[model samples]
Target chain A: MTTETTPARVTVGTGDPVLRVRDLQVSYGTPNGDVPAVDHVSFSLQPGQRLGLIGESGSGKTTMATALMRLTRPPGRIVGGEVLLGETDMLKLDEKGLREVRLRDIALVPQGAMNSLNPVMRIGNQMADAIEAHEGRAARKGMEERISAQLARVGLPPTVARRYPHELSGGMKQRAVMAISTVLNPKVIIADEPTSALDVVVQRQVMQTLGRLQEGIGSAVVLIGHDMGLIAQFADLIGVMYAGRLVEIGPVDEMLTDPRHPYTRLLIDSLPKLTAKGKLVGIPGLPPALLNLPQGCAFNPRCPYAFDRCHQDVPAVQQLAPDRRAACHLYPANPALPALPASVQMDAATPLELTGPAMEGQEEVAG
Target chain B: MSATPLLELRNVTKVFQSGVRKTPANMTVALRDASLVLPDGTATATAIAGESGSGKTTMARLLLGFIKPSEGQILYKGVDITKMDKAQRLAYRREVQPIFQDPFEVYNPFYKVDHVLTTPLRNFGLYAGEEQKRIEEALEMVGLRPKETLGRYPHQLSGGQRQRIMVARALLLRPRIIMADEPVSMVDASLRATILDELRKLVSEFGISLLYITHDLTTAYQVCDDIVVLYQGTVTEVGSVEKVIRDPQHPYTRLLVSSIPLPDRTQRWGEDDSAITEEQARRSTSGCRFAPRCARAMEECWTQIPPLFRVDPDRAASCFLRKDAPVLPSEQVGQVLKVMRPGDAGNAPAA
Candidate 1:
């Protein structure tokens, strides 16, 4: 495949993008058939830019992130797409090449501190393992010093290095995991729900630690989480996913404040505000199963403003504004296609009607 | 107001004795002098908001009569629940229903979802004729269709659907009070509002008092009329949700309020230096539990446990900052604990 570098208006450092993903497709082979977990997802990450992939469970956000690193397990395969990491097409790289790319180029801070760390190993041994695996065995002389330095960077006491995973608190373990992931200083870090399990105050501290670490390393971050509030606080750009597709991607402020997509609007509305006056209304139905997703737009069944076009035709991703794109019938690329009725156009000021036919437990499931 | 409360915990203090040989160090003070009342004849919702190990679970367990309080009496309609007979205990169980955090745990994976609804009906001897209609009505009340949710295994339904089914089961009992412990925590954010709305509707429409237990202040603010902020198992602040959230007097309450990541992008967490290390905060067992972490902690705050000082007529915060203020007696505080409206300052206590 020919590598085409699309010029982004808001480049990170005035050069080719640091990490560019094009037409990424990942599918899970179930007993019934092949289910497309991540279908035609594409996004670019500029150097040091924080892109938050916000979605509910089973929305394929995690699958897409894992697929980028080629870390997808059995039954889940990356069928298509180009994962270009600074001129290198990562998809084409072999096992040897991928290993080098994984540690040196991109690292992952997996979800849950408890599951991520090796229970039996000391914190120092875990850090050393990553460093030794990537930087080679000869670099062991200064490994202890490097580990302590990284630990301190994330606000963990250097004495914590000798302690086991269970010995440290949840917050400390989380910080240690972050330290280990960033010990090598990769170009991009993908932290998946790093603080979801922590308390609010502890979560704040962890987020602060992550922000400081990200700044110190100057690496592009792909933060995946279910919390829109946390994502809005941390991310510069936001991508909203629903049913194995990237519904919308734009600047975080613009996307959050004035989201074009109905799903994005619903997510924002669903969030219980500390300062809200009235009761919050949730989106009516569950997201469609990936195996038997609804025809045309996957979100049509749950979307309050879904029209006839949304039911029959898949909405192509259209550039709604500069540096902003959304896949919805409302924002059609073609001039001939009619936009959604003005009455149903959801905005911050207008409250959406909760009762709908779709909300009455009429879900279409495919066998 | 009635002289007797629907349910009440009088100076409840629970200590969990850990390990084979119990020691003072092993004894975890889950709750310390925690007192609250659920008023009868009105569908008032009070949120027990606290983080893990803050004793929200212990309080819930005490309310459910699963475990006896090490000290203090749990009164139901002015009767001590601890001293209740088997017959009285059964009645209490029927009236006070609990909705736990994980719906999957409440349900058996092998059994059909309908079993959850039918089991309660069968046990209560209400499954003679109108079982199907009653089940349908209960499901409808929680925004679920009987046809869609019934006869399906636990794995077939979503977390939100499963949780709603749990609520539907609770509704079947026709309980006077429903204690929902982190009901929406495991459910998706999109589905949380619907569950919360159902809980709120139960209060208004069905006149069922809800004891919403959660760590998330956002949901508590949305559904609850009153807020009880817990720190290290102690009631840090208990007042109208508006008063507690809008102008939090307790330092811990303020930290919790500010720490929540709002949807607004401009809002950022305070500097790291302002926050106490988690280890330090958790280790301190003396004085004000929040004193080590509190930015405004005075020397007196470190050595003295602050009493529940009345901030206003309807609001009380346990903080040394309000130490100089007039303290309302514990007995009087419970009687006058009316839900205050947004701007309804009946009488302003001098600060």
Candidate 2:
């Protein structure tokens, strides 16, 4: 949490953070027992700052996003956390208060555009419903103009308002969804993989629209996705999640250039780059199951540089630089991170079986 | 390279009827005059890059013989596959294999995962003996341990694991060419690189050519030797990955290259000014398929269809910007005949 107050070496943004999440914990109540989907994760976002949370499936990125908006469904409960949006604690808000704060203060651009939009509802009605839910329906004539403006904001033509969801293309539907979510001009936008199923060109256009809207509204954004390239290109700050934990959080340039966490480094290296082409590298073992995690560090079984201490004690999130934080044994508080092994420094393509001695007896689940 | 290409699609086009009734209004041209060549005697990976509805999948299905092309021929080693008999068709199926997009849907939940590996062996008549050895070798080649993957249900394995097993199954046949359609799109991000690496290894280690069909251009650029960029069933650009990605000549190719979200922070995506809607693309029936969305659309682009003009010795782009460049002699005039006006023969390129 100290990293939130620290003046970043690079000018991330100039303002007190509008959204702060402290020790956020979310769990799913299963028949066997309680399974923590999101561990004690903490981060803050200054107004107009773009924070990208990158993780693989079941890494708790979506869980954290839903929890921030108090949208955790049944079986998934927010056990502990303080979601401070401006001055009010979102966790303390009642249903009525939460509804008011949701769209007016915080909005969500959900992943699947096809399922998110109502099939029968016209695009303009969908946008109107979002506005009329918070704003009273007295100003009926102005709603049409507002709807067209929102549509035009995301690059959709005004004619799109007359059509149904099925009538529009995939990109148009996604842009329409964006328009609906931002109609209220919320202070924080939680876009959960808005471009997952879209094509590369359309994905670019959608991201640009989101960026432009965020800038116009001066809202902090928490963009969650699995694509490393997309996160790096759009976000100012990057947060890498693993096994329901924020393994590393830092500036995008710094994290990509010199990553402190081993998982972050391996994940970055795994991505196929446009700048260069070579043998592709992927993380060796599968991510640890959330229900049955390793005793010490969750990533110990796959990390090449993991040592003895990493297997016995869980590493707390430690501040490595003025603006960066990582949870790894390689970087102690007093001496910063030591030099990594030569094997990891060589190329993106690490040997298939490169792992520390801690990997012994880890029962990898078989099909 | 050999005298004949390993597999060649000579001016192929596929049209699908959209409505229950047989009508031209309901006909959707899934593919239009798409041609490709995979040289023999050398291992290469060629990527067919396009977005959804761009006819990339149609081209893949055509090559795999899942559907017949309405026009042109699909040749294998200079012999037409569509005209082949039962024995030749079986042989052709063995020579070319497919790795589908969704790893989960491909498997039947009723059977254990081993059925996937063994059934192919039996069908190809390679399971008479040493079946276990061959299966293990294929799995190991794709970085899957036989102990972890074998004797398990498809549900028990991860998406990445299932995809790797599919790659292993494809390898078991020792096919000359593997047609992988979006092989890694369904897998997790961390596992995508592993699957792509395995696909790359099939080229270098096993001496097999790869026809990688996907919308993701970054991965294509990373692993492929050459690329064919398609836009709404039309082949817009074809060249080596280096030349095409580094310096895109076609306007559509340029848009695609610029649209990809790279990892580098310094270079961000430029703002798009042109408003090229999908409706406009649907309306343009005769001109270049991408002219509606193309930033460099001209008067000629609206009427006459442009052939693949030679940007370089090995590169070609279907754009009027390359009008002065020599036209590729391969299926140029014949392929564009569908879009030609009644008296447009005078403007046709010299063969």
Candidate 3:
């Protein structure tokens, strides 16, 4: 092995975080106004930490993934934020500097693995391209071995290096993407729904492979998806996003068992359990549209625990305990989230009337 | 409650040919020797649970008469579906309704949401002077206000609303059985529970049997009474959802049940699972489809195909581990109950 490609050994969580985001904001420019997709989001990732970001369809989890890497396309602009990659501000980096820092330090495993790979390029060439772009040209034999090894690391056989993207199955294609993204041993890997299209068996296997890879390279991973069960199983810390804001962020055990935010609690309660079968409970009303949000909190209309103060002023994210933070008016005052009212809990089993004044605002946007 | 079954699939097999000419090499067995029965007068929900390419959709399409089965028969109330007369076919069409997977694609863009509700009434010639009242009642059954949901185009409604409208359309038919194909898969997470609750209400309040086909086992366990676990194109396990999910007998079913990521944090998935290559899966057609990936595979598992073994009075699993259990008769589903009872034939191996 060449000295230039030697793997670096860094102690995990002993020093500064590998990635830190401060008041990040991303907006989509429209004719009416600039619609915020990721609004004032802030978080940090220690070395080897696995953070799973989850939300509904329009909750902007995927947008957070793209904005973190500065890959937001036209019509969507990174309005303001500081994405610090070990003190290097990514937003301030020039074009060439940004490109160099992307795969070399932070890599992105995009949402759709089927369409992410270049159709015309061979699998080996794609791996070689990612490697050659970072480090100049290398010996052909060594390059081939490295490519085969990378594919094998993700559980793909050496023969996979000779095949094209179409020749692989859905699970294999996702593994190939994982292999390519981790070829450089990136400090932070932003994987967005890497296993959405896969079945349960393959999804489990893919998550296992991702876990093994992260342990091998000691890289922090930001996994973004909509499945709470999958995220709870994989992530060390869970962050809930809603309407362009980070609603809850804490350790997985604390987040699932004793979630502080009403939206987080509703989202967790909505999942059907295998151990107990009961009436399926869902959050009443739909998530508000970003363009026409409510007066205070975006989730105020759907929140079962919303009080009078929640409708008048926005609640800033407050630290409830060490390593736990939630953006809700109930926290910092109440020691814990109070039990949901019996009437509100009953409404979860029954459908809400759309004619109610609280639901009228959401109906207009939904209609 | 009745002697005859509402709907039945008897040894049905469907194969699709890919090449221009008919050949065994290019044919794909979408469904193989599947049999199920929805007894008449019972409102139980049976879930056909499987992963993608496991032939759950093929079973649904075969029941809907969208495609003909290659080998066996699909019967509706003691008569073969393909042999039904015009009047019988119309009755079948009116009694058996379908709730498609994608609610958005089922609607026409140009028509208002009222079009879906009115078409069924006009088709059955039930649109007397109470057309408005009937539509309103059906909509109210699924918990949708008739005023706001009517007169709106498909694009103007949310996914949850559109799905509720589809449920209302099915309810208007007063169907005996509704084949809901992945009804809650496309909806948002928070809305999924609401839709599932509505489906459960159909069975309790309206006395409608539901054939729920889906790849999600959690939702299936919640809403279904009995479960049929399909692997590839074959039935691996079938029983009460409670018993089957609690103690899965088939190797594939066990793998599927264990693979589901629960919301609890104390239980984490182990890294011991190893995936089989596509080549191995394709080559093991002569034997069990899961033999290549089975952790307890024996030498005989590679060549001999196991029959569905009667493991319980109401349960059956196709696996070599239950070899001592009696083979379930495949001819008639009603005969299955008579062939084995609880104490008379206490020969089934413990799960």
The C-alpha interface RMSD of every prediction is 9.4, 8.6, 7.2
lDDT of 2 by residue, B1-351 (tens): 456767888889899998798797899988888888776776777899998899999999899888999999999988898889999899899989999998878999989999999998898899688999999888888877787678878777777788888999999998999999999887877778888987887887787889999888998988787788889898888877777888999998999888888887666776663565666655564778878887668878888888889777557888999999988754542222211213432221110
Computed on C-alphas against the true complex, the DockQ of each candidate is: 0.42, 0.36, 0.47
lDDT by residue for model 3 (A1-367), tens: 1111112222244567999999999998878688888999999999988899998877888888998899999788999989999989999999999989998899999766889998888899999998888887853559988998899889898998889999999999999999999999999999998898888889888888887788889889999988899888888889999988999999888899899999999888888888877778888777776777788988888887888999989899999987899999997989988998887664533454453221111111110
Q: Given candidate 3, what's the lDDT at residue B67?
A: 93
| Candidates, ranked, lDDT | 3, 2, 1
When candidate 3 is compared with the true two-chain complex, its DockQ is 0.47
User: Per-residue lDDT tens digits of candidate 2, residues A52-125?
Assistant: 99988778888889999999997999999899998999999999999999989999999879989999999998
Q: For residues B236-268, could you state the per-residue lDDT of candidate 3 as single tens digits?
A: 888777778889899889889988888875656
Over A189-210, each residue of candidate 1 has an lDDT whose tens digit, in order, gives: 9988888889988988888788
Compare the candidates by TM-score and give the number of the best one.
3
Candidate 1 residue lDDT tens string, B229-341: 99998889987888898888888888898888888856665555334566655555478887777777777787888888988766899888998767755544464354333
Candidate 2, number of clashes: 1
Q: Among these predicted structures, which one has the highest lDDT?
A: 3
TM-score, candidate number 1: 0.91
Maximum-DockQ candidate: 3
| TM-score list, all predictions | 0.91, 0.91, 0.93
